[model samples]
Target chain A: MFNYLKPNNLLKIINKTQKFVFIIFLVIISIGLVEALILSPEDYKQSDSVRIMYVHVPAAWISLGIFSLIAVLSFGILVFKNKNLSLITKSLSPSGFVFNVIALVTGSIWGKPTWGTWWAWDARITSMLLLAFFYLMFLLSWRVTDDEKKAVKISSYIAIIGLINVPIIKFSVEWWSTLHQPSSVNIFTETSIHASMLLPLGIMTAAFALFSLLIFLMKYNTELIKIKNKGLDRL
Target chain B: MYGKKVKLRAIFILSIFFSLILIVFLVFKSLEENVVYFKSPTEIKDLTELTSKKIRVGGMVKEKSINVNQSEVNFVITDFKNELIVNYSGSVPNLFEEGKGVVAEGFLKDRNFFTAVKILAKHDENYMPPEVEEAIKESN
Candidate 1:
């Protein structure tokens, strides 16, 4: 299972599949944009502003999901002592942070017309802000350190510690009083969103996930090449 | 080759453990005050003092309670047992209407009055805000 993730082997796989991933990502995103912008019915109440959800919800979902993935990868490093796992965690951080920013900005844009405020100190909003802080700390661990090994170890720890915020972000609306509304799509129960709205949202989410993976592969490949070239300098 | 490296690893692990504890404590402490809970008109009426902290009031908009002017709109939020008047000076959400559930965020001026900075309607038609659901339930 873990064998495929070895740096050289993973680099070979990425080199082979990068084009396919990019093509699929482009196709899915184009279809999603069409469905979201043209096919879906305008919201009865929010009107065109509701279209923002097509981007905001998907970005928010990916950011939270990727952070959880980082936690799992961090644990894999502990169990297997694999440097590749640490490098992968580093590669995924920027994508997650990018999505986090998109979610916040889009949410604010949606909030202004609907919630009547650009921002609030609501539980959901605050926890997400905290998640962004954790992302910053993870990235800075790499930037501020000269020792590559020490930076990897410190970042892995930060990733693990940050896992606590994921569940909080998921349950904040249910647990506390917040300006943000509860989730529209529920995994176990029936979803409140209509199928027409759901289709574009699903497509957008798939596109974002594929795009993140594509970015991750490119980043991991670059990082691997840098390490391979520097192998002798460290010794 | 063995003892020094093992000792350093142990210290590194311990420091991370302590830092995690400190962060969790600080987060909860700050969140304790910032977390605002939803209160119905009945609940607001029960309160003896008008605190300065921001609060959210949720309930059905009273029938014919809305008074619109050039600058501001005033309405009453009711939970059957009690009602609190809310005044605001912004563009209300399109869904804001009489007999619909709405949540207003602002400060309480007195037992019966609220000056709202924002009025939030439901995010979707099928989804009612949980606070509004709870307020309706409590009212019944």
Candidate 2:
């Protein structure tokens, strides 16, 4: 399984899968946007402003999801001493950071029309900002450390410590008096959203997940190439 | 040597964890006082004392209770059993109207009077906009 970490093997996998993944991502995203923006009914209270939910919710979902992935991968790195897991974690962080940024920006825009404010120090928003800081710290750990081995260890620790913020972000609305509303969709029980709205949101979420996977694969391939070049320099 | 280095690293990491826990605890404790719990007009009326601290009052706008002045709007928030007057000077949201659920965030002047710095309109999950409803009615 670790043989896949080799540069030549990763290049072969990327060559075979990249085009297919790109086409699938593009097609799904295009269909999802049309369904979300046009096919879905306007919200009774928010009107068209609710359309931002299609983008905002998925971005927030991806951000949280990817950070959790990094945390798990970090565990694998420490427990199994798996270099491959570290590479994958490194690849996923930028996408997670980008999604976190998108979620914050879109949420601010959505808040203005509904909550009559661009920003608030509410628990939900503040926890999300904390999550963003964790992502930044994870990225910065790699940059500031000169020792490759030490960088991996530090970043892994950062990811594990930061995992606490994920649950806080998820439950902030329910646990505190926040301006942001509670989640419309809940996993333990029935979602509050109607099926008509759920379908488009589902599509967009799938598209975003697939898109993040594409980015991860590209980043993994680049990291493998860098490792190969470093080995050559050592020789 | 390897075991000793590992022990030091473990201690460092554990210290970081404990410090982070302490920070979060302190932050939440301080913020607890600042966090204003949402209350309904009925709940507010039942309160033993009305402090001047900021709070949020949420309930439906009473029918024909809104009076829009040149700079300020005065309205009544009702939970059917009780009603509280809310005074706001900033522009109201587009969805804010009679019978809609609203959350007013500000200091309470008294059980009968509340001054709102911000107003958030809450809507039900139903998708029947007035224009869409009118269109469907005409077609029917």
Question: Which candidate has the top score in DockQ?
Answer: 2
Q: What TM-score goes with each of the models?
A: 0.83, 0.84
Per-prediction TM-score, chain B alone? 0.62, 0.68
Tens digit of per-residue lDDT, candidate 1, span A1-235: 5544445666688898999999999999999999999988776456677899999999999999999999878766654566767888999999999999999999999888876678877789888999999999999999889998888878888888888788889988887656678888998978877677889999999999999999998998898778667763221
lDDT of 2 at A118: 85
Lowest summed lDDT window (length 10), candidate 2 chain A: A226-235
Per-prediction DockQ? 0.26, 0.31
Residue B135's lDDT in candidate 1: 72
lDDT of 2 by residue, A64-164 (tens): 99999999888767765678788889999999999999999999998888877788777788889889999999999889979988999999998988987
Give the TM-score comparing model 1 with the true structure, all chains together. Answer: 0.83
Native contacts retained by candidate 1: 0.29
